[model samples]
Target: MTTSLAPDPAPDPGLDPAPDPALARELRRERAHHDACRAALARMAEDVAEQVVTGEDVAASGADAEVLGRHLRSRAKEFGEQPPGPLFFGRLDREDGQSHHIGRRRIAEHPAEPPLVVDWRAPVSRAYYQAGAHDPQGVVRRRRFGWAPYSAGDTADLTGLEDEHLVSGEDVVSAIVAGEIERPRVGPMRDIAATIQPEQDDLVRSGPGTSVCVQGAPGTGKTAVGLHRAAYLLYTHPQRVRRSGLLVLGPNRTFLSYISEVLPALGETGIRQSTLDEEIARHEVRAVDGEAAARVKHDVRMAEVLRRALYARVALPDGELALADGPLRLRLPAEVLAGIVAAVREEAPPYATGRERVRARVVRALQLRAERRAGPLGGAWARRVERARPVSAFVDACWPRTTPEEVLAAVLADPDDPLLTAGERAAIRWAKPPRSFRSARWSAADLVLLDEVAGLIERPESYGHVVVDEAQDLSPMQCRAISRRADFGALTVLGDLAQGTTPWAARDWREQLAHLGKPEAEIVPLTTGYRVPAAIVDLANRLLPELGLGADVPAGVSLRRDGEVRLCRVADVATGVVEAVKGALAREGSVGVIAADEHVGPLTSALEAGGLLRAGGDGGAGGAEATGGTADVVAPESAGERLSVLPARMAKGLEYDHVVVAEPAAIVAAEPRGLHRLYVVLTRAVSRLDVVHGEPLPDYLAS
Candidate 1:
């Protein structure tokens, strides 16, 4: 029962062309199906709302009933409204003559009736994304529907359809995929549900317990794959994921805002998203450390140094312990008291826990000795001896309670402490010491140190899974911090080694994975560039040799080869950037002007002066105002004609339709890993890339 639409042709000048009856009939049938699905969804929403618990029931059942009622009300609110996107995008046809419409959510008229739309995460919808001519997987044909914008008070409209015959020996690339990829991006990043390639689908369907490390080049769709995997895991293992929770960690707030809408578009709303610094440091940090200091703090060896310094506080008692209260009198010699303290230290408990245990042990020993010499001491008398000033003083002197902050301050205060070797002291000691502990400034890397010490004192709670984006920039100690959070679970690590811009960036995936506590995790390399044009990617690939990617660097594949990479030399860099941005804005989609860290302020000012950048209180300046580090200036509106002035390092996971890069040589000279940072900035263009430079280009690029 396949319905095919006939192709319509233009009429000749002198003759009247007859309408294609089959085309009209097919359009009517599809329209009817769309209306029916909408009606069914409306009815489902009504049913959920009517089932809300009443106030009388809540009153009778007390607090538990009230909590349950509130949860139901929240769920009802979510179900009552529908978003603007199409409900169903694809349909799968099986060899057994069965058909199912694939959509973001499931919709059924009744319990006994077949579902009108099958959720994309359902097992039956796998063929829609994975089936091909070589391996049909029992699929006959897969159809993708094109949607028209919905009008006010109107249901969604299905305008057209494209089909790929799985058994016809044709290519997997369909017209639907080409249109979806080429569509103009007006707002935040959207889900690539309709255009997910076969290779990406494989990673998305990986099992729950499997930890995957994706070594993806620019435009390879790694971020999309990670988000899709989160949604897939939620569907496959709902109970396990819901109980322990799932988290997505990004590089910065600006990057987070760029991808904030992706999960909700994929029908997932409960997943928590945060930056690594935000997760590790819950409080506000006002001060920052320089690059040299941050590098030293982020080093993994600092963990060992911290451990030695913390445990150095525990020592043997130097004085005798004498406690006397009425009938209970106890006197222990210095040697015997030292032995007791040494025995407790041998157990290697936390400093605070060890102090409490020592006090209890001294009290018990005194009661035992008193009973042996005189009559048996009562429980009340033993309690009085435990509270005696002498017993408390002995325990405090032997095992002092310490906080993570206090211990970190003590380590940094003295440059020549024995716990730190001469070389280690030189590396970690502050160049200009703080006046006091209260004035000690903590950097982003220092936050990781605090998390590490907190972990050593007591084990941290573990999550079910963690998705870490831009993981190659994470230091060894930072990796350990993230690993501790998901110790018993799995991780989806995403990054390009060539894109790592930090001083302590990972050199290889094997060593980084070991630090993450998943040494055996599978490493998957995605070299295909589906988003960025080939011309732009080729320009960026020139830095591969410097990045140690070797001669086997994979060139990205682009469907549209019409993109141009322009290199211009100008007298003034700021003027050239403003002109380039104006030209890009005149075209379509968003535009980004990426410059070096020191050049962002001048570049932003120039753009604003030229009236190219909008100014009315957007988040454009928030990234610049952020403490510790520099970030991209994200415009509040990301729609048509929107512009973002970014530092080269902040362009990691973001893409613009057109990009203007200023002074390539200056970007390469900004930091130790500036070449890698420049490579990241060059490949962020989806359609075209314009390189404008006032100074000579880098040696690698010029050659």
Candidate 2:
């Protein structure tokens, strides 16, 4: 199409010459551009919402991309234009009619090839912080801090206060107690460019608030805010909040490692972190039980010796069983049986008698060999031997009256005793006995909130600000523990109600927490997400619920236009893996592979052994060792291959730049808990997202 050429209009000398004609023309052009940009923004918002609702990733549409570029271009011109008259439109109609273009170039031309249409304003943009506060005054404010410094004695110095001796004089004691105060620990603060959404700030800063239940959507910075609040508490109420008094209950070891540095970065410390399982096990076994529990080992070696020598062909090899048969053969007195039972009840590792002990060893040796072949039935046989009655009433009475020495002799003399079942062979094979593995000692450290943790929270020296990040994953049991010990400090709990990973326990944690007397809690809801591209977030919100995951968050969380969500179909399961691997590499995404347990082994093997993918756990490409860097596997051992290739049950509260859900078909057959996990995996993507497998995409995503 030919462009129209118009002759320039001459300036009038009679009009007020204060405003230059060229400047006026530029203002007029900027206004037209600004109005167009605004309309494009409004349209982009509407389009994103519609696509999200209709189950489409916003980045998949071309018009959405064009609009984003135009909006940016228009905004830049409006702000940079010298004569800013058009920007200060006097009437609402004129301003409303102006078009807003975001691109740096002219709207009439096509955006540069491979157009950058990312809406920096969208919470999902990587450049979000660069957008900064809209107020020009705030942008130029001087920065007063730098990165935090690390010190070796930081933890030790704080803990050393316990060793101090107090002065006894009345005047001196009063002065020391009243006037002596520790120096405040101030850390460097990064310039937060993105304006903290006004509503979010209000929710976080409200006073002595109720137990704040912040149901944050994924990518919404729940953990970041929780840490920030702790820093804020330390700043505002230094007396009420201290570093040592704070405790954090996380989901697992990985999460603990993931958020370990946040508090320190904010110039605070003393936040205790641990998993729920470790805390519970330790508390129940040690402080609660008050007994040193060890594995029970029975004493009956002598019985096995006699049984083997007397009836080697017919005797059962289970030594514990043969030992039980010892009592039957001996016809031990009831009083004597009671003695052995009493010794067992006392949990004596080594029984008292030396003579009987030798016999018990022989019996144990034979039974151990037999049990290896007979399996768990060995224990059952031993119980039967102990319970059997004597052949006659007088015999029983006589047995109960017998001494340990007498019982031993009686058992040795009668090897073919009634306790030996027919067709059972007594075989005594002397081999090395299996040593019982000691039960792992779980730590009571994280159990600071548990009632049994003596002086944990009640102490005046504890941490002052406690934050429970990912609070939704915490169970009532966990919350109880957190409340008791954490009560000594201010509490900040953040999580998304929709993505409660531990619903089995947390289903009632809310009520349980209320009963614990934390009724006036601040419940903050973050409706916007600034992590994933808007397209990715929109897809997640729309389809996540269909998969029985996440809360009903608004589409604003992912209202951006620069990221794409695509589904790649593979010719077969194996081919699917290759496609996923290729696509992930092509995008330079830190790839994540998620599958069912059944598929984890094969998929992981194929990816690692076949040299198609790296072999590591949850972090990123560098996770894999130097086997060959074609793919860097980022998997941790405790997390297992399932963490990298398995379903969502293992992937909750985690994210990756690119997530490859390998076997979608398996998700449908998964249990409710498993299904929830699958949903978690699907939604944990940032930029490029795709699902590949023989199975179907989650119903929500498909819908």
Candidate 3:
């Protein structure tokens, strides 16, 4: 069943070499399969669009008919909106006949027939990623197809095929695998369904109920793994996921945009991707925190401090409560009221629930008193007793209504708290306090504290699954916010400790996972470089000790052999950067020109002066502009625009074919964890890394 292609013919003296007959013939067969699958997918979309919901069964109910029609239309839209690419990317041949071909989304010709293309996320496709010459997993051969620019099954789109004979125990690496891995990364991050490695596949297929934490180094494909896990959960547990929801938390909007296309490319749509600040925002961020103030707010102890401040609002009733019961007034002593409050507080329910429980207990006591006085009472009497003004007033005064902003404001302004010293409180307190909670100008750190209060006030709604990337930089308080949403469900935590650049960045995954409410979650380490080359990874490893990664483990090892590392010194940093970017632009794939935060402006001007990085004069910056203010994202992802100029911090989660880093010392001096930030910058190059500096490079990076 394996169709092997003949080797290419050797070239004659000055004549063009003839195409291999077997290669040409196999390409034809693959194209025919692609066209057939494309046509069947179109037909499936048409069938959904043509569906008729009969009204006869529900003639009296237009609502039922409208709902059914909307559902059909939604299905039609989903089918039509599937990303246009090769229908199938890989195929597995087995004697037991487990699969026909593996694709992004399944395609079938008929409702009851076996699919023409099995979804890559399907259980049967594991062999494509995991099977090898040593462990074939029941597969005899595996084939990968190479695709050209997408054009609805064009004549040349399906161009080449390569295969591995598992039964022969041949260990040669396939040329197609290498080509796909080293392919140019031009647009938004694409789905790696075609190049997923065995280790990554294990993480991607982690069970729906299992929480996992991935400590992936640069170019380890953790981001793609997290996204694919979301898609996998959506497919495996559609109803549960749809009922509760699925969410992905990234470090910034720029990261969110760079990965926005990944899920959709994998046939998943409408997933809620957001940053932690966006999720926990209670007010507009009109204030900023200094380093010390931010560290105080992000401390894990802040969770308990906020909880105490919120509960401090609750107090015992000062006096007796008089209840009018069936024309007879009843008086409950303050001692009884205090007892009820104590009993409910002892239960330790949510703040709001505690209030409700106390009120209910008071109502019950009043009912029992009424029943004793009049033998037996109806439910109507209890209702009147519950609605009494005296009862409402008593409960309101004891356990008052409040908001997250109110609690946070009170805690910040209160100088008497032991948790915060005099100077600490003064540092965090509003220098010019707002008129009230409504007009309060909250900082990003303040929003995280507010989320803590909100969680205590009432448990935040739970999601079926959550994927938090760049988790190493999340402070303890931020992890609490994510934990609140996934309290009852699972998580896919992804990050690297060496990439932690925040003042309060995590030093260990165990402590961070504890804050995420998944202390026992399995921790998986991925240090193999897939997208990045070995030279760049080796260059980054020099900073590992400075980043706190111990020497016991290998820093990282890239599987790629072809990569370039160049360190150049020049008299002018800006001019040197311009030349480096220009040189990189002449090569294939996207280029990223990164510099220190303060240096981005000068570099931007230089790039524009050199006739590069043109935004069409305010027409728009496209993807770069849409990334918001997370970083100084400069260049747009426009036509013929292969270069993205950004600050060092913004390069944390992004990769390019060739990267240009300007002034290594400046990047290392920009912040407290500048070395970690520099480590992140240097490892972003997939093929080549050019470090251009006017000053001497960081000691760690200097050879």
Candidate 4:
């Protein structure tokens, strides 16, 4: 376990050296180590599969044998598949002279042999990411390995290595971070395990019990940090987290797809990734709401209004509860029944639970009345009395059954309902009530209300941890919906307050935390920009004053300053976007042409008609494209067209090497928080930002 401060020796003098002998030797050793780890992992997989096969025999003898067999077979298949990626990315040298290789997963040899690769979440591997000159934490040097493009039937090439002397006070700035940030964008997002900065690493390694709110600017690696934190918690607290589960919630489906691979690349799987709407609705939604209606639905005041409306269904029975059995008859006076309903109401349980309590109370009263009259009546008589039609009818009338949808429909259908006050009624009433529950159309924001009501009726299942990205866009009730899912667990809230782009978007982090039921959670700000360059960030910051973020505006510093921000006034936006996409496609990485939602159709058509863009099926299609009126092109990485026409609203938490923003003014005019939306679009580029506007830019950007 002896560690070496000295670099690896040069290649043998007699052998022909490839480029740099020391680097070549290191790569060769690392490759051999990778091969060993792969062999060990194969053996581990074989052992796991064998265990599953053995368990199948035992499970076959049981009544639920088929169910158990299916689960085992699925697990065996997971163990058998070898995902492509580097075996390890870093090596940490501890103060006790121990060296540990850090990778996406753990790998070990026989009991006699030491572990070949330690999981990145291991405590000893923390130095690989957090160790620095300021706080070496008992580390001498840290090494980072670089990988070549992955090819079929082979693991990624371990081509290069970078070293940092944590205790030597040596400058750490090198090609390692710059190269990672500048790496060509292909397919979904890759893990930042090898390039995680100290600040990001701090958040990733936070304690499991500590909830955190990361206020990170674009390119600060907030999403990556959040995902990695989930992986870390799963690895460190496997039993606790596995039992409660973990989830990563994003702003939209496209955003979810964009970051889908990050967790798996870090050797974590089965972690649920969902959009807020998907998580809330849990089913297909065919309805759409206008901006005004959506805003009212998302308002925080709706919580109080909905609460009153749901409880309004509860009422005391007007008559007595009378139960008759063969030779025995029991009568509970109306006042007694009223008292029982009052007791349950005083506890204020869920509306559904309250109904159950009232039914139980009625049965108890019948039993007591029968026993007093007959001097300990037989069990048969009590059972028959409880099942009497009169008792059932009374309970049904006192507390009628209802669903979340039914309650919501009733409230919206009646403007003068007693549950709604003057202001609440004005804010939530539908323009035209549906004729029936089957005809009512529910909007995305309405789904949050449904979720709220559902939770009030029956407590929702909670998770071990919840990582919410693009949190600034979540309305108060939406936050509450998410909060309910992690009542006993911690949360990792990630977003840029200045990037809030919804009508009911939060004005401050404090307000958002309060709504999420984690007001005491620590708020950490990450201002450094690693993905988007400084030049582009500066240009985006100009819109912050208009956003009214005040002191919370993030100051971003990029690792590389070689990025361009071009603002051009064009006669036609569609033509300008097409030209911009063509120029960006000619570059090395992925390109995105972001425009207002209404403009996506025209731009998509323009690109398709010009034959500059091809349609991609995997991208979540909406608006005109969903109905097949126009093609919304979003070419998959393998399609060889590294370009996508993205709606501006879907642009948050996504980064492209080159970005073309069409009509900033139009983006601003599309919603009440258009200025904030424009800011988000302006900062989506990693290498370059091209602004193409037919109309004048927003006032802040214009100046």
Measured over all alpha carbons after superposition, the RMSD of each candidate to the real structure, in angstroms, is 5.5, 26.4, 3.9, 5.1
Question: For candidate 4, what is the total of clashing residue pairs?
Answer: 0
Query: Model 4 off-target regions past 4 Å?
Result: 1-20, 59-75, 111-113, 150-156, 282-287, 325-328, 368-386, 417-435, 570-579, 597-611, 614-639, 694-703
- Model 3, range 159-251, lDDT digits (tens) per residue? 567778898986666666676777766666778898899999999999989999998888889899999989999998998997899999988
Which digits, one per residue and each the tens of the lDDT, describe model 4 over residues 1-703? Answer: 1111123242111122233656666667777888888899888788778867787677345657876776677656656554676788789877689888988878887646788998888888877777788889898878876555442213335555777778887556656456667775666777888778888888999888889999988888899999999989988898799789998998776677778778877777778988777777744676787666677678777787788778887788787766667687678889999999889988988888888788777887787776776777676765665567887687778877878888888878775655445765666677788888667888777788889899888888899899999898889999999999989999999998888877788878998999998999999999988888888988887877777778876666676678998898999889888888777766667677888888888888898877765554333221111212223344332245466677887777677788888898888888778888888888878888899998887666766
lDDT of 1: 0.75
What is the lDDT for 559 in model 4? 66
Instruction: Put down candidate 1 lDDT per residue, 543-585, tens digits, no spaces.
Output: 7877876633354556555577889889999999988877886
Q: Name the runs in model 3 displaced over 4 angstroms.
A: 1-19, 52-67, 97-99, 149-155, 551-554, 615-639
- Which 10-residue window of candidate 2 scores lowest in summed lDDT? 157-166
For model 2, residues 1-703, the per-residue Cα lDDT tens digits are: 0011122132111122243455445434444544554454345445545544444334646887666655454444333331211111111111123222122121221234221222212222212122223322222211110101222211111100000111211111111111111101111111121223345554445443334666677766676666655555554565554425546666766556556655544334545666645644533443221111100001122233332322222111111222234322222334543444344324422222322332343334445554565554456664443343422222233112222222222332343444443222122111221231122222232232223222221222334545666666554435555565555555677766556644332443356356333656655567666555677776666644553333433333743344667776666775677566655655433456776666766776777664554555332321221111123443332222222344455555555666777766675456555554554666666655777766556556675
Point out where model 2 deviates above 4 Å: 1-195, 203-210, 278-463, 503-516, 544-556, 614-647
Lowest-sum lDDT 10-residue window in model 4: 620-629
Candidate 4 lDDT score relative to the true structure: 0.76
lDDT of 1 at 452: 81
The residue pairs in collision within model 4 are: none
Each model's TM-score? 0.85, 0.46, 0.92, 0.87
Pick by lDDT: which candidate is best?
A: 3
Candidate rank order under TM-score: 3, 4, 1, 2
Best by TM-score: 3
Candidate 1 regions exceeding 4 Å error are: 1-24, 55-67, 80-82, 148-156, 317-398, 415-424, 430-439, 551-562, 601-611, 614-641, 699-703
